[model samples]
Target: MQQRTFEDFKFNKQILNAIEEAGYTIPTPIQQKAIPPILAGQDVMGIAQTGTGKTAAFVLPLLMNLKYAQGEDARALILSPTRELAMQIEENIRQFAKYTDLRAVVLYGGLGPKTQIAELEKGVDIIVASPGRFLDLYLAGNIVTKSLKVLVMDEADKMMDMGFISKLHRILEVVPRKRQNLLFSATMSELVHKISGDFLAFPTIVEVSEQATPAQTVTQTLYYVPNLKTKINLLQHLLKDDETLLRLIIFCKTKTVADNVFSFLERKYGAENIRVIHANKGQNTRINSINAFKEGTIRILVATDVAARGLDVSNVSHVINFDVPIVIEDYVHRIGRTGRASQTGDAITFCNPAEEYYIRKIEKLIRQQIPVLDIPGEVFIEKTGFEERQAIAREIDAQKRKDNPDFSGAFHEKKMANQRTNKPQHGGKRYIGKQKPVRKKR
Candidate 1:
């Protein structure tokens, strides 16, 4: 088969011009397979990882179909799991629809919706939104979905994981039943499949590659860190190599850990060199941090999984998993941030003993074992402290108990034996009490 180009899609001059300006010459694998079906007005279920040009595959066709602005109400609605992803999709729509007269508005919950409502009233061709904010506006009578021609659930799997199923059902009830439905997800779980059945009508399924597999362009390595302090030590040691670790993203499991990592790196690299983003950060602060990272003003960003799905900065030299994600599927998305646009990048994971269970699950999900690398001799490996060690031990015992309810783990047995040894000496005190009673009677 001959290779196909974006020009072959025969998009309108406006879209073609924008594509050319964006420097997109050839269609990616997902684009190659999905764009044709999308252009044909077929319901499409796109299964592809992030950074695979899936955004362009759907956006280009949607723009071409809409052509120019028509009525005030939105013609299309794109739902995302996170505010960051929603904003990114809106940005893509704006770029692709630059030459056309289409207006797009982004709605998310972090900031006030007054400005978003104002923009919606002005008339928009597309509305990219997070589920909660979208439902909120729709309930407030600010958005009229009767005119919606296209309904897209970007990152459908993530939406389900974030507990948006009920919200999705509510939105589905309001939209036109005959509109085109496009569902895109990185992984196809039972939940995604079930949701697709509800939304799509005999959709064409497009799978560019195996599910949950990291892109081959990313070189992955793993380190067996003993504890949190050791992981921090390893991170500091690795960051000392300025050449290889130029543009980096460090992903922590939670906001607190992300903040701790950011503080440590900020102390070493200075506040100007690093930024942290999580749910606790204000909307303006998160936006500023992302912009700085994109502009190369900040070399490193410490973030939680909130940034995993939608962040698309180019030429990220390294994606360091400061903490392994408990949700195994997130491993693919976290690493997908790097090795984008056919550029080679590195994905390094730091795993402690407690995280090993998740690592095993991740390997199984991805169908590949991450190659473990020996810690460098020069890097100092901190010993696990008493509190952390006991915590880990207790966690292990709890897991064991979960597997076998009747089985008492070592921790439980030790506790029971200590209680028995500390029991009061009832026999030794009873004789003394009886003698005192007899003397009083006499």
Candidate 2:
């Protein structure tokens, strides 16, 4: 079958012109399926990974529905898990809706609500907001939700992962129940499904791809480094070849580690070459850093998972996973940052022993093996410290226990060994190894 174009969709001339202006001619699979249902005033459940034009899949139709601004209360409410995503959606709306009189405002936490309240007072046709901030404003009487006509939950799985289920429910309660519902996610978990069940009514399910599959444009590789220090050494070695790894994002599992990596990179590559963002960073600082990285002013970006979902920077030459994501499905999203829009990109993952379990799960999710490469001889591999070794062992044990509720951990095995040798195994007496003791027993 021939592919569909943006003009083929039920879009007004204004939307079509905006699409042409944005240089978007072909509609992606998610867009092709989702736009019709959305425009027809039906609930839609879209399962698609990042970099698949999922944002536009929903945003375009929404822009068409709200052709012009009418009232102080928002007609559509788009809930994103992160402020970055909220901002991104708002930006996309502004761009597509620029030809019309529609107005949009993005609301998120981590900043005072005074400015957001002021924006709401000015009136907006659409509201893109994180759940918490939206709830806060709605409860505070700063937001009038009686006019809401459409509800969308972008990155629903992420919201569930971030423990925003209750907040999602609260937002749902405040919004008009008779409105059309839409939920989009890279991977749909049971929790996300539950929320969708409550959120969508006889929805059209549009799945661009199955769960946890990374982008085909991304070439993935894995390095089993011994510890954090060696991972750094490998990173330094790779970044040394600035040509191939021109624009890179280093994903860390924790904020402290991200900061540490940023500091190390800053020391070696100069502070101007890198910027880091995590939950602790100020909202403006995060936004500025992301903008800098996107503009190629920064050669590297070190970040935790919060930045992983919201980042839409294109032409990222490589994505280096400095640490395996604690959220296994995020492995797909992390690598997705690099390979986008028919561009070839490298996704290199550094895994320590403790992270082996997650790496295995990641491989299963992506349905492909990450080619393992030997660490370069020039990079010195440091031995794991006593504390780090213990930490790794404990983490592995916890992972095992999570998989198997009755799993006996390494520490448990040692305890059992002691019980077998140092104490009685059963309710019986300990056996003697000597032949004399055997004859007495006979």
Candidate 3:
């Protein structure tokens, strides 16, 4: 088959101009497969990983269908799992609709809704929102979904994981039943699949790549570190080479870890070079951090998984998984941040003993083992703490039990025996306890 170009899609002059300006000369695989069906008004279920140009696949067609601004109430609603993603979709819409007169607004939590409500009142063609904020505005009678022509659930899998199913159902109940639906996700989990059945009507399934697979452009490597401090040591050692480690993102499992990593990097690289973002950070702070990272002002962004999916900074030279994600699917998303736009990048994961279990799960999910690399001799290796060792042991034992219900691991037996040994002798202490209470009263 001959290669297809954006012009072959027969997009309007406005969309074509914007595409040209955005420097998109050719359609990605997902765009090639998904855009046609979506433009035909068919429900689409897009299964693709991050950084695969899935955003434009749907956005371009949605913009084409919208054509020009008609009514005040939003004609299309795009739901995202996180504020960052909602903002990203809105930005894409703005970029694609730049030549057109279409108006778009973004609604999400952790920020004031007053401005968003004002935008809705003024009238918008597209409303990109997180589930909770969307429902909140809908309940307040500020949003009228009767005119909604398109309903898109971007990152549906993540929405379900974030416990937005009930909210989704509520939104579905309110929106017109006949509108076109588009569902996109990195993975097709049982929950996402089930929810898609409810949301879409005979949707066209678009699978550009295997589910949970990282982008092929990324070179992945794994390092088995002993503990958290040692992970930091490795990070510092890698960052010392400013040329190869340019514009890095460090993914931590929790906000506390992200903050800790940020503090360490800030102290070493200076506050101007490093910024951290997580759920606890203020809305303005998070946005500023992301902007700074994208502008190349910040060399490193220490973030929790919140930034894993939605962030789209170009030319990220390296992505370091400071902590392995417990959700194995997120490994793909985290690494996907790098190696975007057909640019080669490195994804280096630092796995401690406990995280090794998660790494195994991630490897299995991705259907490929990450090539292990020996730690650099210059990086100081820290010994695992007693508590961390015990935690890892318990986790391993739990995994063993999960594999075989009847199998009792060493920890289980030791725990049970120790409990029995610590148990007070049945009746021996009762008389002494009563006598001691009486003496205290006297």
- Across 1-442, the per-residue lDDT of candidate 3 in tens digits comes to 5339988888999999999999999899999999989999999999998999999999999999999998889999999999999889888988899999999999999988899899999998999999999999999999999999999999988888789999999999999998999999999999998899899999999998999889999999999998888988998899888878888999999988888888887787789888899999999999999999999988889999999989988899999999889888889999999999899999999988767778888988999999999999999998888888888788778877877898699756875785688753334432244354223545
**Residues 301-326, candidate 1, lDDT per residue (tens digit)?**
99999999899999999999999997
Note the clash tally of each candidate. Answer: 0, 0, 0
Q: Where does candidate 1 have its weakest 10-residue lDDT segment?
A: 429-438
Q: What TM-score, to 2 decimals, does candidate 1 have?
A: 0.92
TM-score versus the correct structure, for each prediction: 0.92, 0.93, 0.92
TM-score of 2: 0.93
Residue 430, model 3: Cα distance from true site in angstroms:
24
- Tell me which residue pairs clash in candidate 2: none
Cα-based lDDT at residue 18, candidate 1:
93
How much lDDT does each candidate structure score? Answer: 0.91, 0.89, 0.90
Better of 2 and 3 by TM-score: 2
